[model samples]
Target: MKIQRRTVNSSTDQVLDSDPVIDRIYKGRNAQSKDEFDYALAQLLPYHLLKGIDACCSWLYDAFKAQDRICIIGDYDVDGATSTTVMLKGLAGLGFTDVCYMIPNRIKDGYGLTPALVDRAISMQAQRIITVDNGIVSYQGVDYANANGVSVLITDHHMAAEKLPEAVVVNPNQLDCTFPSKTLAGVGVAYYVLIAFRAYLRDQGHDLRFNLLELIDIVALGTVADCVPLDKNNRLLVHHGLKRMRSGQVSHGIAALLSIAKRNPKLLASDDLGFAVAPRLNAAGRLDDMSIGVQCLMSDSAQEAHSYAQTLDSINLTRREIQANMLDEAQKSLETVDVKNEKIAIVYGEKWHEGIIGLVASMLKETHNIPAIAMANDSDNTILKGSCRSIPGLNIRDVLVDFDLQHPGVLIKFGGHAMAAGLSLNASRLTDFTEGMRALIQEKVTDDMLQKCILVDGPLPQSHRNLPFARLLLTKGPWGQCFEKPVFDDVFTLESVRKVGQAHLKLSVRDSEQQYDAIWFFCPESWFAVRAKQVRLIYALSINDFNGKRSVQLMVQHAQVVESLPIVS
Candidate 1:
């Protein structure tokens, strides 16, 4: 593992009106000017910049005017749920009465717009079909829809294939598109489509009775939950959305989700959406039909939303149990091999729940600091489906793409992003697939890339290490993905230590000036053997409110004995 301090260009000489700490953090992230930190809706890029939006909007306008029966095909993830909710709400607000949605079953229907999905849409008597969060690579599905006299509009953010679908595709990653921010999530793209649709309606002399900005909350949930880089546009969406959530101006579904998750909407942050709300919504897709999650998001009644949220919450708990058991099985399977010697970790089990394999793969990748693939026997015993999670340098999708190209027909189907992907193959071909992945990883992944790096924003001055500063940092702007939260590295002397839970260390520490309370979570009992009174710690300052009394605390990320220079200085 490597610990590196992020460098800030303090000499750039740009003055900021906000807190110096916030300004420094923003500057460290290469913010060109203070305006970059302004996430107002007015600062967002124009919807016209999204290449296919205008055309898609024109198509949607025709559908709306004709009162065409429309069906929305949504994926089963949180992004899909949010995107689906946004489209459903937006279309209804625009006075499109005949609109319904379909969420694909993860295990049965797989991903994206498919032929069977198109058939379902046709059966629904849909004259037009819109796909949210998916459909860019759905060539056959779009062909089927077009052949069936159903018009299709794709609003996706996935990487596009060389030959695109026949539908009107609005993906930023498309070859010919010039959207400034290519990393918009599927939900973000859907929101852009709504923006363009609103513009189109306004041009056509239609008075919109509803405000579309109210849907910002849904877009914010999806954008942050999808783990897209928090660029300026994304930040703008999330910042405004967070404001709405905090003020209790969100939708019934969002309000219910917040209540069921035990999160105070008044203190909601981007992390809450990613860690708490999104998982509950995603669980419905992972373990069962994602329609439950989507319905929860789309429900207008508070009671209905709460009921759906509770159901999703229960499913999420089951998902956690299944994920834990699968990860345990995966680790036990890896014990036979020298994990350090392997370039990639490939593990599988018979009858392992297919839905939870991706979580296991991610856990394995994080734990071993290596590319990992976790496979499970599909419904058909002759085929095996696997999920791949990759390290920073390796693009897992490209690996699968090249492998499929090199050995045609080896991969039954594959899709995903740089860091994660999914594929299926013949059961007998597992050995060949493992070797191919290992070889491919060896060819692309560097040794340094395998090492985990902890990035710190230099040392925090003692002057700024108080309850006020900690609270300010805690309640600050949405931090996620590329725009990371502030973390600092400094030395502290352990004054006292106590066990908080089964695997946690609560400590009182002292620096040269004062003592601070700190907590090291998930620190196993065995880690006490390596503990030291004087240690260098990488930590984030946070405010902990207990019984309405707020105090500063250091959330320790990593610590080492102060015997030598810090690792990777």
Candidate 2:
């Protein structure tokens, strides 16, 4: 991709701290440093509120003392798989052999703890069951386990409902949770629980030789993959994880994944995990079976991991093709309606796959800049399975709750966080539900929230477009939701623009002082309407490593030519 370069004033003046609004928004919290680790640990919430950690550790300690059966109930997603692997490896290090793990098939068991899964655990004669990445809302499943005389410990990061399950719950979002960082991903929370468990074991005179921190690699993978905000504690977890991964201490499965994605282990970044590795891990859960993913993580042999990675890679390709076809059909359906006039956009099709509804909803939100919901007819029972993606100002779950109150007995079940949600409803009620959602959104949404603006960080100088600077940005990041990767604005004189890859813009740009290359992916041709003389650009700095040679490149996000007005002097 060719990136256009522009020259701007090289002003190094720092903004004064007296600006309160800017300070609050731009510099909310300074990035964490290594020196803050000890202080962070000291300030962490008490061990008891962490939920399943203490209980699970205590049970494991007793099991070690008495030699009883232990099994881990693992979820199928990236977070679930990584957390399970970490627990299994950590327990094995502590000389536990009776420990085993079970990952439910996405198609067969759906999500979280279920009665069927509980029966499977019972069949293994498991004395204690520890759940990873799920089970906070599994009230019935937890009750079933308890009735069967199996102790259950739940460790999850999803939003909790009004009432929680009876199992020892260790979620940061719990009603009475006092954890400073409420944004910890499931794996990060699981890692913290493990730390607490190790501490308890050490206090009891157990010989746990391996440092618990080594598991940060798995924690980082899950945290990034789950799209958790990179807050203070999460940054530390990911930072340590990236360090270990770069040092070649990560698991063989992760190494194989990186290899398949053509990513260098030593040059791993959070983006690599999110865009490259995470999707492959998620593909198993999305299309085929999550057991493939969990097994890949649990694999000790490099050959076995590589084989699973290949299977995941193939599945991911198929997923992308399916997603593209669904998105195209959804966009066509959207074009026939005036979504801009409505507060919320709801669309459905019998052809849309239930497995990819969430992704389609996300794409619709991006395309229309509104909270969008997409539903698909489930072939099994003719039920409407839908997913919603909301904008920053909209609380999708609350919206659904309002809709539920308006039309009682319409929605079968729904639950999710502020930005996204999922639900099941009768196929016959689709039109009424869609109209209700649109009406509710119209009442709540404002005009200013409709226009989509690309937020850019500080402006960039032409001098900063070099390999060293690109490397600096890459290495200095564990960037995610809150702490976004930097995007710089520059005024470039477009020398020429050409089409590439069907819908991409390949541009050659130059300023008064220098010239640069850039590319804008999937941007429309209408972008050229801006006068080329004073075109403005917003882009992220990246390093292009090809054939063992590295150079700087810009990935354009948005561009607009400046509109000149009549001079009034």
Candidate 3:
């Protein structure tokens, strides 16, 4: 692994509001001024700038005025769940009482708006169908709805296809659209649609008193959970959402989820949304029906929210167990192939759980520092479903696209973002698919791109290596994806090293002028077998709590022995 620090300009004196170190970190992340970091709703771009939004708003207004039955076609992930909930809540507040939602089962309907989903909506006598989080690429489903006298409004954020459906599409990624932030999560797009619709209603002399800002909690959760880039617009959404949650002014569902996850709403952070809440909500979609998850998110009664949250929590535990077993099985299967020499890994099993293959793929990608695909038998034993995960430089979806183009008729279907993708293929074509994918990845991934890189915000000065600095950094962020928590790399002399509860390593280390406690979670036993006194470490500053006391601690990310270091026992 390589360690490097980001560069920042020295002319940021007038723009920063705090410690010079924090200012440097912010500038290194491309923050032009302190205003860019502000979470005020006024910082968001006007909804009018979003292409197709005005048209969507007008269409929805006309439909609602006529009391048209509406159905929201949602995907099954966290983004889809929150998008559906936000749209449903916002629509209800806008006097659309007949609105309903339907999310496809992951194992049954696959992804996006299928013709079957349209049929279900039609059966419900829906006059208008709006797709949230999915439908930008759902040409056939959109056409099906249009043919059946139903208007389809697509509010998606995924990359669009060339031949788009003949519906009003509000995706920022569309070719002609110039929406400033293309990284809006599905929920963000839905919220913008409501904002535009509210404006249109006001023009029509309808006096509606809907507080759309209250829906920011779900918007924030979905945005962070989806792993989207934390651009200015997204950051603003999360910031307000966190504020609402911390102040106990959030929805019953959010409060319930926080309780089940053992996270105090008063101390909520973006990290909790990703690590605690999202997994439980996503587990329902991964293991069963996302409708249940949506029910929890859409709940208004505290009692009902708690009941649904407990059920989801139980499912998330099952998800973890299944993932762990599948990972173990996958590692055992790797013995058949030379994983060390392979540019990419494609592992499969006859009965591997399809729901957990994506998690397995992610684990393999991070452990091996290579692109990986984990495949399992589909419901039809003749076809195999595969989940793929890629490294930074390799766009897994594009690679799959090129592979499909090169070898037609092999891939059943595939679509996802740059780092992850999903597909199915005939069971017999597994060999061909693996070989073809490996060739394509080898052609694109350069040597430098293949190597793992650990980035740092330079070394922390002794003066700033205290609990106060750690606490200050925590307040400045709901960080994830593009906006990451600050980490630093420095040389330290090891004073002690010992194994903790499971696989973690506890250490006491000293730098030039300070001694600090540190911990490395999930450390391999072999890493401590040949311990060295002087080590180069990449770590993040953290406030460690023990016995009702808090102190500065370092959570080590990577560690290596320094050259010419003598073992001092």
Find the candidate with the highest lDDT and give its number: 3
What is candidate 3's lDDT per residue for 147-220, written digit by digit as tens?
88889999999988776888989999888888899999999999999998988999999998999998999999
Alpha-carbon local distance difference test for all models: 0.86, 0.78, 0.88
Give me the overall lDDT of model 2: 0.78
In candidate 1 the C-alpha lDDT for residue 401 amounts to 94
Residue range 1-569, candidate 2, lDDT tens digits:
12333222233233323333222223423423234333244544455666445666776677778767878888878988888888887777767788888888765677889888899998998988888889988888999999999888888888787798887778888887767778888787777777777788789987778877667787889999988887766776787788889989988888889999999776677889998999999988888887788778777899999999999999999998999998888888878688889866788878877778888899889877899998888767568889999987889999999999999888999988899998999988887898888889999888777777665665676666777667666555566777777777788787777778777887778777877778898896786433355667788877766778766667898887764434456
Off by over 4 Å in 2: 1-53, 527-534, 562-569
Candidate 3 matches the true fold with a TM-score of 0.94
Q: What is the lDDT of residue 338 in candidate 1?
A: 74
lDDT by residue for model 1 over 146-168, one digit each (tens)?
99899999999988877888888
| Candidate 3 residue pairs in backbone clash | none
